[model samples]
Target: MVHAETVAGRRTGSPWLPFAVRRLLGLVAIFVALLVVSFLIVQLIPGDPAAGLAGADADLADIARVRHQLGLDQPLGQRFSDYVGGVLSGDLGTSFMYRQPVLTIIDNRLPFTATIALSAITIVLLVAIPLGMLIGVLTQGGRRRWLDTGFGFVTGLLDSVPGYVMATFLVVMFALGIGLLPLFPPAYTPRFGSASFVLPVAAIVIGPICTVSRVVRRETAVVLGNDYLRTARGWRLPAWKRYVKWALPNLLTSTLTVSGLVLTGLIGGAVVIESVFALPGLGSGIIKAILDRDYPVIQAMVIVIGMIAALINLLVDILLGLIDERTLGGSHVST
Candidate 1:
């Protein structure tokens, strides 16, 4: 016999449907807001895009002609309407500096940024998860207060350092001081085989590792305190089976949610890290565009970053719903 709660849950559609729809709507709203804010901010920046395109030595008449040609002579409302329409139609327009389509420039540069971001995330998960699990297990039972305190202190210290500062430190220690690696090479590209990728990935990984580990440790500690965990311990089950098969699954639902946020932050961090490492990625491209006041490139980059972040959050939400039935608005069933 189906319960009333079950019927209500069914009537609401797939348990995750409402949540997914809400999140999707929110994501669209955020993207729209970003577009408006980016457009307005670019307009407020000094120097005319038309003038910039016309060249410094070009006289007023030449600038005016360039503006008219670029449709900048239109009323602000019409120009913004066109800009928003272009965004909706997936036409980010052309780059004033490169004379190439903005999407083309982004496509060319995306792989490098993606490689760095993925590498950093890989390193973070590989190192942080195991280390955090170990710390959580060892520091359980509240008997070893010092161990927990020490771990917290270390992670806190690491998190306190900014990405740029950490990048500089890594460069000084590994690249310049020890003379161990090349700082810069002519026409460099980031590939998996290159030794040059290390410092930037390392710098990007540091804070995330610290932050993720702390979250995992806290969650693990909480899972350890659960009544079922106590019962499992009383039953004399092997430590590995108890923690790995049982405790870890519960910890992951929470840990992964935090990891999604961390991953999004890594995208922003990539900009600074790429610049510091002098990598030819979107981050460096963004810096150059900002200096040149290249509106199309800047707006496109912001939107791309927002989309990536929103997708990550969506995936994380779905995963959480799958892992914990209660999160899908269903009753939790204990096996």
Candidate 2:
């Protein structure tokens, strides 16, 4: 009893489910490809595995014996198979330099790193969205050019400053210069009630918040300039409600994408900031691994960081699609 017009409308309206399913599958395949590529890239780095394991003075016979024991004599295909199997089984192989299981190293350090990343992201989103919205709304009146100019300058300055510089300046001013806190504590006990993590979290948040706020401000300005928003304003609706209903939804979709990029930037930035503050996060672990050339630790850290970045971007895209059906449906029709 369904007419052709009804069927066509249904098809257009319900296209999102199939499109979303395809995007999800694409995300999974990309992550799998990253894992395989990471394994191969790490294996390709030139080095004497035995020398990396044992000291340079280790006897040739002992080195050969160690290589044989570690299955370095196997073909590349077999090694790759073993690597994939081990990864699937939650075994990241032994660290030639650290002489411990790679999973143990990652497992021990994951909580601290996750906490820092989560805290930094929370700070960025919580602070940036409102600030950007305010700036965007005010600048729309043509009376706040100075404010907009000042905000732009400050954002650019913060974005240009590296995380380490900001961290160091904070440490000098807050800890050494003011003597209000300890000079970059060495151990992080990770107690929720403790005051230990406050400064470090603040340091990570500063650059990201400023950067995210700038992106949001720019995007919100563009969104507010759209004809729909202008039409809403002409309707004499309540100013705040008009912005909330019309401006924020569009701004936030774009902001979520910027937030993902900030999260990606956080991976590298956190390493330095965490190290400078001596937080026992994955960042510190990466620094130590580099100093010691712990191959498994380094590779595992890279894989974790890369996966996190990719996953955040994927989630952001999904969020954008879900929040704005117009975009999703439009893209589906075009495809």
Candidate 3:
């Protein structure tokens, strides 16, 4: 009979089960860290949540009552304990500024943020992958020096530009300068169906497209150098088959890894874009909350955003493992 340790040591069987369990634990660790960091960071910031909630005219008794009501008057350890308990029990606390439950506010605006973030990432994958692979195929073996030079310069410039700045520039050019489009569409909430949705999504994707495509191109160039690819070339296989069949499968691991990381970052970018476009989403809400020193709203926002990011990375990690089972246990895959 095989020992359980020996069976485990072989590193064979369903890949995702163990991977999912491990990453789920990692998600817990990340959640705990986010809670601690968010709480501590807010504490470090100047000003008082109670004072903001009570208003300038509020007397000492009013501030004291508000503080006690919000549990701010409790000891630090007790406050943290209560905060953690509230989170585990699906209580995100109430927003002092909005005078509503934090989850309710997030629930209302979350769809907008989700739409923008998901749409931007989807575009990045669709555009960047094909564009990068095509460029990589074209520029292999140091061919097309001028095209390569131009590509590098262009993508680098675009990648360096932030999403908010990109949004502003596009607005200035299309709406304000050329008079082709309507001015910033922040008047109504922008959704997937609205024409107003175009600019913000465009802004978030532009830089990420540049970054991902460059990575893909570099990976493609490297993949072209492998022995199997050389053998394919030896057979004088057509360009399309050699790359589409031989190269794409290999490219999945790296592309997904990079795109997943970019996806998380796109959440934060969407926040900036939402504000620039004047959308009523988490971005605008969080900015207002910060200005008001609304700790509950800030913590809730951080938690929601952090969960989205963690989930994205977890999905990516699982995909990478599925694509290449060797990645199931990073730095510890038994041969």
Candidate 4:
């Protein structure tokens, strides 16, 4: 989820260089580990990819040629080395099923996924955080206990519902019954600006917002009880000034951490939403690759998603450290 910047006592510590470098190295290790797992998973699958490519009627010669073309004929160690080298050099190889470069396929499909994910994240933060703030304030009076209880009940229900189920409900309400929007007809070219895109994006957003708002509400309530906040109230400060100058800075860290988790979850959870909406995005690409047994696309997608998630989490950590000098013990701020 995305968040608006709030005024805070300037963040302290050199959190950028060291934290980012460490995160990059960690991401490299994760990539290498994921590569090994991917290779083994494919190797252990019931059927041979080479034979799968060449049909049941094909002769040994055809299978051999297919194996050689796919580099399966090489010794396992040699193939592993080549795989690692190719990955390091950004040559993830071509897709046997798509008959296209893996990079090309990713380039063609990534934007739609990015757009949907970004929009969902933005929407979640827009709705969830403010609602959380409201919940936090209400809880202070002890007058709206049901408000939190009601929100908790609704969030639990939403989280329990499958993403596709939610997407279908939205489609039925907006597209079928009311005819207020198009039903995402097959082969439809996805455009972010289209009126039809809202429902699908909203489908992705609702579950995450419900989850995040709960956390934000709890954290904000805690932060409101901090010493600085208590002191601000003791001084009889204006409400708006107190929230802006004291309460928000302390609460920013919670927002960053929650947003990082939400973004990471979106990468994996977007598949059902993407398929339901017929959007040509990374989630759909992954489903297509799995059905076709396109190893290259699967491998590349896994690595890319892992890296993006790692980078976002690392950014959150660094920002947290920068935002609160106590997080760094005592140091100059990083750019």
RMSD of each: 3.3, 3.4, 3.5, 6.6
Residues 107-214, candidate 4: write the lDDT tens digits: 988887877777787788789887877788778646688988897898889977878999999988988889888766666666766776788888888888888888
Residue-by-residue lDDT tens digits, candidate 2, 179-222: 77664345655654245556677777888788888888888788
User: For candidate 3, which ten residues in a row score worst on lDDT?
Assistant: 182-191
**Model 4 residue 91 CA deviation in Å:** 1.1
**How good is model 1 by TM-score?**
0.90
lDDT per residue as tens, model 1, 273-319: 98998777889988888889888898888788778778877777778
User: What are the lDDT figures for the candidates, one per model?
Assistant: 0.86, 0.76, 0.85, 0.78
The candidate maximizing lDDT is 1
Query: By summed lDDT, which 10 consecutive residues of candidate 4 come out lowest?
Result: 1-10
Clashes of 3: 0
- lDDT per residue (tens digit) for residues 91-124 in model 3: 9998877788999999888888888887887899
* Clash counts for all predictions: 0, 0, 0, 1
- Judge candidate 1 against the unseen true structure and give its global Cα lDDT, from 0 to 1: 0.86
Error of 2 at 227 (Å): 4.8
